[model samples]
Target: AAARNQEKRMVADVKRKEQAVAERILENDEYAQVQEEIERQHRAYEKKFQDSLGRHASEERNRQILITKTTDKVDLIDTTGRGVRPFEPSQVTTIRDHSFGLGHNPRKSGKLLDDVIDMVRDKPE
Candidate 1:
């Protein structure tokens, strides 16, 4: 009877130790993930701050930062300067000929679904 009791206590002790280790590992992983997310947010905020300062250069990119996108043409405006400093309007550029208003690269889009539909339609009645 004493030997059986000793064996039971040993098993319980092992299980308790394993549970503790698992809990510790899970807690550390959660902490690491939270830290990584915080860093990502910080980086994004930093980029926004830099872009705001640069996009408005000396004369504020000549205040011509109005990006236009219509059915026929799509225009994109950007400052040709980098870093965390304001630049002159000469450093700003525009891309009025972008995309040419044509959507997609015209490459077998949804080919799988079309083929499946074709197979069903070709079945003999």
Candidate 2:
């Protein structure tokens, strides 16, 4: 009878240890996920900060820049004197045609669907 009781106690102890270990593993996994989320947010914020700084620098430099869109037509000037002249008509053979007047460059313009719809509706309907 004593031996049986001893075996019962040993089994109970093993089960308790197993439960504790499982709980610890779950907690560790949760902590890892939280840590990864924090790191991703940190990287996003860092990239945003860098982009803002670059824009600010460019804005500052653009103040005194001089640029001419049509070389023979007129001279364009910005603050930094680094303004670029628009290519002549003869040099504009690779012009992009936008279904909507969003602009030639889709990536740079980033016009949304809603904006395009609005523009179309605003046209002579």
Candidate 3:
């Protein structure tokens, strides 16, 4: 009877060891799965960020090209206008130079002339 009791205890001990080993293996597998999931998410985020960067670069290139084309078109228009109707430099008129001492000048002065010319030249008819 004592030998049978000893055998029972030994069996229980073995079973407990086996259960502990299995639990440990399961925990390790869960950890590996979690690691894999994190790696996959990181890869996806990196790919998305790269794709967005590529798209933005392409858009910037297109914008620069558009600006260049617009500048060339403006140059062509200015050249054509000058060819058709040339502009003579305005002669400085003898007037009371009020703007020499005062900060305020006539609105129809050289600065305003340049501003009007810039507006007319930049706008599309």
Cα TM-score per model: 0.43, 0.45, 0.44
Question: What digit string (tens of lDDT, one per residue) describes model 2 on residues 12-110?
Answer: 999999999999999999999999999999999999878868967677545423222222233332445354854333232223235445534343334
Model 2 CA deviation exceeding 4 Å by range: 55-125
RMSD of each: 17.4, 11.6, 12.2
Evaluated at residue 15, the lDDT of candidate 2 is 100
lDDT of 1 by residue, 66-96 (tens): 3222121224333555646754332232222
lDDT digits (tens) for residues 56-112 of candidate 3 = 777876766544444222212243445656532221222233344355545445665
Ranking by lDDT: 3, 2, 1
Cα error of candidate 1 at position 68, Å: 14
Better of 2 and 3 by TM-score: 2
* Global lDDT scores for all candidate models: 0.55, 0.57, 0.61
By TM-score, the best candidate is 2
True-structure lDDT of candidate 2: 0.57
Better of 1 and 2 by TM-score: 2
TM-score of 2: 0.45
